[model samples]
Target chain A: MQVVVPFAAETPKTRLRSVLSAAERSRFARAMLADVLEALARTGHDLTVVATSPLSSDDDLVGVPSTVRVEVDDRPLTDAVDARLPRRGRTGEPVAVVMADLALATPESLEGLFGPDADVVIAPGRGGGTNALVVRHPDFRADYHGASYLDHRAAANGVGASLETIDSFRLGTDIDEPADLVEVLIHGTGRSPECLRALGFELERTDGRVDTERSLDSTSADSRSR
Target chain B: MQVVVPFAAETPKTRLRSVLSAAERSRFARAMLADVLEALARTGHDLTVVATSPLSSDDDLVGVPSTVRVEVDDRPLTDAVDARLPRRGRTGEPVAVVMADLALATPESLEGLFGPDADVVIAPGRGGGTNALVVRHPDFRADYHGASYLDHRAAANGVGASLETIDSFRLGTDIDEPADLVEVLIHGTGRSPECLRALGFELERTDGRVDTERSLDSTSADSRSR
Candidate 1:
C-alpha cells in the first residue's frame, strides 16, 4: 500500500495568527512531511507526498529520504488527490491522504488506519476536521475541505465503501497556535525539520519550561482529540 | 547570586570509547556547550563557566554572553571550585557549583536550589552522587569526591551549615550510559557532551526504537540510591 499525503503549501485562510506564527506554519508543514515519511518507512509503506502549491520544491523537502516520491499539483488539495488517484490505482495499491499540519501524527496511528480489511479509514482532528484519510480503491473520492471528517464519511457512504474511524492523538494535534507549539515542545515524539523549527519557537517563548508533566499533558490532549 | 558551572575540558579518567564514539563525543560536547549558553541567556543568570582543565582557551567559550565570565582553573572539579570560592565570597556573592554532565539540568532547577538562608544546597544525582552544590561561604571546606552526597552532608554538619536538598528528576538524570540517551531524546531535556556523543550509538544500535519509558524506570531506580 502507498500513503499519499496531500499538503497545501500556502498559508491557512483562518485568522488564527495568534496560534500559528510564520515559523510555526513552516515547521508544521515540514514536520508533517517528516513524520509521515518516517511513519511510512517504519510501517513498510511506499510513501508519496503530493504538494498542492507551486511554491513547494524539491529543495524545500530536504532531510526527506530519497526513496520517497514527490509530486507537485498546482490545484486544490482535494482535486490534486482526485487527479492522482487513477494513476496511483494503476499500481493496485491503497492510498492515504494526510494533512501537512499535524505535529503529533505517529506511525502507530497510521498503521491503525491502514489495516487490510478497511475500504476507507478516517482519522479525525479535535475541531471536527479530518487529518488523515485512506481509500483502499481508486474509485474512492471525497470532498476533503470544510469539516472534512463528515465529508469523508459521506463520500464513503455514497460509494458504499466500508468505513473505519481511527481515534489517535498523534494523528490529530495539528499546530495552529502558540499553545499548540507548547504542546509539541512538551510531548512530541521523534524529531523532524519542522519539529525542530517549531521547537525554536517553543524555546523562544517558553524558555525551557517543558517538564515531564507538561509533556504528558500535551500527549494526553493529542490522544483525547483523536 | 552568580551561578558557576565547573567543567573539566580533559576528562582523562572518563572512558569515552565505551560511552560514545569519536564523532559523537565531539558533537555532544559542542551541542552541550551551546545549550548551556542558551539556557543561561534565557534564564537571565549571571553565568560563569570555569574550565578546570588547562587546555581550554578563551575562544572555546564563544556564544556565552559578555556579562557571563569564563575562567580557567587548571585544577580538579572539586579543587577548582574550592579555589574560586574565596574570590566570589570577597564580593559577598554566593557560589553554586553546577556540573556540566547533568543533561537535564536547567535554569529553573538552579533557581529552585538557590536559597538565601541555606548555607549549602545540593542536588543529588540518581547514582547517589552530587550533580550540583551551592555554598554560601568559601571558608566551609568539604571534600567532593567519590560518593560525594554523603560526604557533602557530613561536611555541612561539621561546619554547622544549614543543608537543603531538592529532589528533581531534571537534576537527577545525568547522562552516563547508552540507555540514558533514550531518555534525553524522549524527554527533550538535558544535553551532555557524552550524551551527544552517544547519539550515533542511539541512531545505529537502536534504529530509533529507544524505549524512553524503560530509560525513565532506570532513572527512578538510580534515584532511589540517592
Candidate 2:
C-alpha cells in the first residue's frame, strides 16, 4: 500500500489565517510533511508527499529522502493529489490520503487502517470532521478533506466498497492554533518530535509580562463558553 | 526559591535486581534525572540535582547543564536533599523537593503549589506515594516519598507548618516499573526530549514489550474483578 499525504504548501486562503500564525503555518506545513515521512518510515510503507505550491529556488522540500518522492503543482490541493495518485501506479494498491496538519497520527492507527479486507477506511477528526482516508482502489472518487468523512463515506457507498472508521485521539488532533500547540505540548502528538524541538514554543513567556496564569484561565473559560 | 531533586547515581539495594541490565538501568536513570531537570527548567526555577549514591561519577551526570550543580552523598535520598538545601542559601525562601522519577511534573503545577504564600506542599503519586514536597523553610522536614501522605501531614502538624496538597496528573506519575514507561510514551513526561533521545531507548522493546491494548484490557478486567 502507498501513503499519499496531500498538503497545500502555502495556505494563502483567509480561513487558515485565523487558525495559524505565519510561523505556525510554515511550521505546521513542514511538521506535517516530516510527520508523514516519519510515519511511513516507521510503518515500512511506500510514501509520497504531494504539495500544491510552485517549486521555489529555496523550497524546504528540496532535501527529502530519495525513497519519498515530492510532486509540486500550481493547482488546488485535491487536484494535485488526484493527479499524482495515477502517476504513482496506485490503481490496485491501497492508498491512504492523509492530511499533513494532524500532529498526532501514529503507526498503529495507520497499520490498523491498512489491514487486509478493509476496502475503505476513514479516521474522523474531533469536530465531526475527517483527518485521514484510505482506499484500496484508485478509481474511488472523493474531494479529499472537504466534509471528508461524509464525502468519503458517499464515495465508498458509490463504489460498493466495505467501509471502516477508526476513531482515535491520535488521529483527531490537528494543530491549527496557538491553543492547539498547548494541547500538543500537554498531551504529546506521537509524530511531533521536530515540532516539539523548536525553542520558544511554550505557553508561558520567560519575562513574565503575559500573566500566563490569567491567560490560561481565560482561555479555559472561553473554551467552556464555546 | 531553590528546587532540589534527589536521584540515586547507583541503584538502591532494593532496586539492584531490577537494575541488573546495565543498559536498561542507564536509560532509566538518565530518563528520570533528565525529566526532573527539564521540568525545573520549563517551570523557570533554579535547581540543584543531588545524587544519593556514594559512587557517583561525572560521566553519569554528563549532558546536564552547567547551571545545575550536582551533589553526591552516601546518605538516604531524603537526607541528601536536606543536606544540599542549606548550602544553596535557601533558608529564607521556599524550596520545592521534587522526585527525579516523576516525568509528568509541569512548571505551572510547580509554581501553583507556592502561589501567594509559602507552605509545606505535598504532591502524591499514583501508587499512594508522594512525589513532590515544597517547604517554606529547610527546618520544616517530613519523611518524603513513602506510603505516608498522612504521615507527612502529621509531621507537618508537629512542626506547625501550613500544609497544602496539590493534586495534578503531571506530579502524580512516577516511573517505578515497566508499565510506567508506557505512560511516559503515551502521555509523555515533561522531560521526555532528552530521555527519549538517549541511546538504547526503544519504546517498543522496553520492559519485555509493552502491549498497551493488553494492559488496557487487563485494567478493565481488574476493575470488573474489583
Candidate 3:
C-alpha cells in the first residue's frame, strides 16, 4: 500500500492566521506534516508527501524520516492526488491520501484507513472536510473541494465503489483552527504538540470549552526572535 | 464552595442497554460516578452526591472518598438540583452542580467552572446538554431538560445573572452510550477505564473509526458470573 500526504507549503493554514504568524504557521504546518509522516512511516507503508511548493529548508522536514519521499507538486490538492491515484483494475493496489495536518493521528488510528474491506474509505473531519481516505478501486479519484467528504461519497457511488466511512477522532482532527490546537495539547503525541508548546501555546478553559492561550512572556520573546 | 453531583441509581444509563447488560450498566455508571466524584473531591469542594435512590452497598461507592456525602433524592434531575440551588442574596455562597457521568472530568477541568468571573458558569455537553455548572446568583436555578445548556443560558439571562461558559472537553464528555466507552479507554485517568477493561472491552478499528469490542471469553464469563 502507498500513502500520499498532501501539504500546503505555500500560505498554509490561513484559518489559524489569527493565532499563528506567517513564520509560525509555516513551522507548525511542517510540524503537523512531520507527525502525519511519522505515523505513516510506522505503518511501514510507502509514503509520498505531495507539497504545493518546495520545502524551504531541512528544518521544514526535520522529523520526517529519510525513507519517505517528498514531491513538490505546486498543483492543487485534488489534482495532485487524482493524478497519482491508480485506476481500479489497473494496478489493483491500495492508495491512501492522508492530510498533513492530522496532528492527533497515530499508527493505531491510521490502521482503519488501510483495511481492505472497502474499495473507498473516507475519514470525514468535524466540519464536513475529508481529512483522510483510502482508494482501493482505481475508478475513484480525489475531489478536494468544499464539503469534499460528501463529494467523495458521491464520486465513489458514481464509480460503483464499495465505500466505508471511518469515524476516527484522531484521524478526523486536522490542525486548522486556533481552537484545534487545544486538542493537540490534550491528545497529541508528536512533534506538532512539541512545536505548539515551544511556541508557548497552552490549553485554557473558556466559553464553555477548552481553548489555547499563549504565554505573555513567550509572546514577547517569540516576537523578538521573529 | 459547594458541589452537587446528581445520579439516577434506579435506572441509570438506559441508553447503554443495547451494549451493556443491567448489571454491567449499573457497574459502569457507578464507575463513571466514582470518577466524577474523585475529580470533584480533588478540588476540595463541599461535595454532595444526590442520588435518586440509596446506594446499593459499599461496593457501589468504591474508589469514592469517604469525605463526600451521599443523599437520597428520588425526584427528577431538574427538580432535584433546583431544590438544592441556593437563591441569590440568601447564603450568597457559590454552588456547583456536576453530572455524575463525567468520566473525563479532572480537577484542572473543573477549575474553570468555579471561576468567579460569572454569576453562572455552564459547561455544555457535546449535544447541547448541561454537563456541569456553578451558580453564584440566588435567582438562578437548573432546568435539566432538553437542550438544558441553552435553557440555562436563557434562564440566567431571564434573571439577569452574568453567565460564563466553560469550554472543557474533559468536563463536557459524559459517558452515556456504549460508543462513549471508547473515549474513556482513550483519555480516561480513573477507575472507569479499569472497569471497562475488566469487562474485556478493547479498542478496535472498524469502518474507519475506533470502537470498543468486548471479548467473547469475557462475555461468557461475565454472563456466568451474573
Candidate 4:
C-alpha cells in the first residue's frame, strides 16, 4: 500500500500563533511531521510526502529504509491529495492519507486501519476532520472542508463504497487550538513533546488551570542545559 | 430557578483512580464542587447539591451566599437527577443540572446556557456523557448514560419540547480521563488546579506527550512552600 503524508510548511499552524512564534511553529510542525514519518516508516508501506515546501534535514525525518518519495504541491489539502494520490482502479494496492500532526499514531492502530474490510476507512477527528483515511474506491475524492467526515462518507456512497469510521483518541486529536497543546503534551508519543520542552514550555498549576509556564530566561537556560 | 448539582462523593471520580489515590480524589472532587459552586453562586439562582454522601464541610462549597441547600441522595445519577430536578408543572421557573467538576464554567456561559429558548439544553462531554443541562419542559428528565446527548435529544422530541445543544468548551469538558487533567489545568479557573498542585502534580514535556508530573519529594516541598 502507498501512504501520503501532507505538510503545509508555508503558513503552518496559524492557530498556534498565540502560543508559538512563526519560527517555533515551523520547527514544531516539522517535528510532528518527523514523528508521523517514523511511525509510518515501521509500517513497511511505500511512503510519500506531499509537501508545500522542501524539508530542511533528513536527520529528524524518519523514512522506510529503502523506499520513500517526496513531492511538492502547494494547493489546498483536498486538491493536493486528489491530484497526488493514485486512483483505486490503477493499482491493486490501497492508498492511505495520514495527517502529519498525529503524534500518537502507532503501527498497531495503522494495522487495524489498513485491515478493515470496507472500501473506505475514515479515522475521524474530534471536530469532524478526517485525521487519517484509506481510500479503496476509485471514484471517491476527499472533501476536507467543515465536517469532512460526513462529506467523505457521502463521496464514498456515491461510488457505492462501504465506509467505516474509527473512533480513536490518538487519531481523533489534531493540534489546532491553544487548548489543543495540552493534548499533545499528554498523549503524543513523538518528538513534538521534546520540541515543546526545548521551547521552554513547562507545566505549572495555577489558580484554576494546568498552564504552560515559561520565561524568556528559562528558554535560554533550558537550551543551555541541553 | 431550582438548580441541582449532583455529587457521587461516596464513589466519586472512579475514572480518576489511575492518576489519583482515593483520598486525593475526594479532595479534588470537593475542590471542583467548590469551583462549580462559586460560579453558580454568581447566577443568583436557588441551588441544591444532591449528594451520594453527606458533605462534612459546606463552608468551602460555595453556594448562593444565602440560599444554597444540600440534599443527600445515594441513588445513581439518572435516578437522583430525575427525583431531585424540579418537574415543569410544579415550578414556573426553569431548572438546571450543572456538573460538579465544571471548573472552567463562568457566569457568562451559564447565562448563555440558561438564556436559550429550548425546552432542553444539553452541554455534552468529550465522551458520551452529558456534562450539564437545562430543563424547561416538564417532560424532560436527564438520561446521563452512554451517548446520553443523543438519548436526551430523543426524549425532548418525544415530549415535543424544543432542544438545543450548547457547544461551550467549558460546558463540554468534564474531567474523566488522566488526559482530561490537561483540560482542567489549562482552562479551569477553579480550586481543582490548586488542589492538584498541592498534590504535587506539575506539567512536564516528555518524549511524545505532555504529562502531569509528580514526585514524592516535590509533594513535600510544595507543602512546605505553602
Best-matching candidate per lDDT: 3
- The C-alpha stretches of model 1 lying farther than 4 A from their native spots are A1-226, B54-59, B86-89, B189-226
- State the C-alpha lDDT per candidate: 0.58, 0.56, 0.80, 0.72
Candidates' DockQ values? Answer: 0.01, 0.02, 0.03, 0.03
Clashing pairs in 1: A19-A177, A104-A170, A105-A170, A169-A222, B24-B197, B25-B197, B28-B193, B103-B190, B104-B190
Lowest summed lDDT window (length 10), candidate 1 chain B = B217-226
TM-score of chain A of 3: 0.94
How far residue A221's Cα lies from its native spot in candidate 1, in Å, is 47
Give interface RMSD, per candidate. 16.9, 17.0, 11.7, 12.8
lDDT of 2: 0.56
The value of fnat for model 3 is 0.00
Model 1 achieves a DockQ score of: 0.01
Question: What tens-digit string does per-residue lDDT give for candidate 2 at A1-226?
Answer: 6788766776622233443445555654675566656665688877777767653445455334458766666666666656544323544766777777666566775675566467778776533345677776556665644345556678778877788776444565565543345434433444353454352244332221111112323221222100
Error of 1 at B56 (Å): 6.5
Q: Write the per-residue lDDT of candidate 3 for residues B91-192, one digit (tens) a residue.
A: 777889999998978887787678657989988765456888998888897887655776899999999999886655567667776666776876687899
For B79-115, candidate 4 gives per-residue lDDT tens digits of 9999865575686567899998777677876776788
Candidate 1 C-alpha error for residue B21, in Å: 3.2
Off by over 4 Å in 3: A1-226, B220-226
Docking class of 1: incorrect
lDDT of 4 by residue, A86-197 (tens): 5755765678999988776777667767788788998865444678999877788987775576578888899898998664556666776565665555446678888887
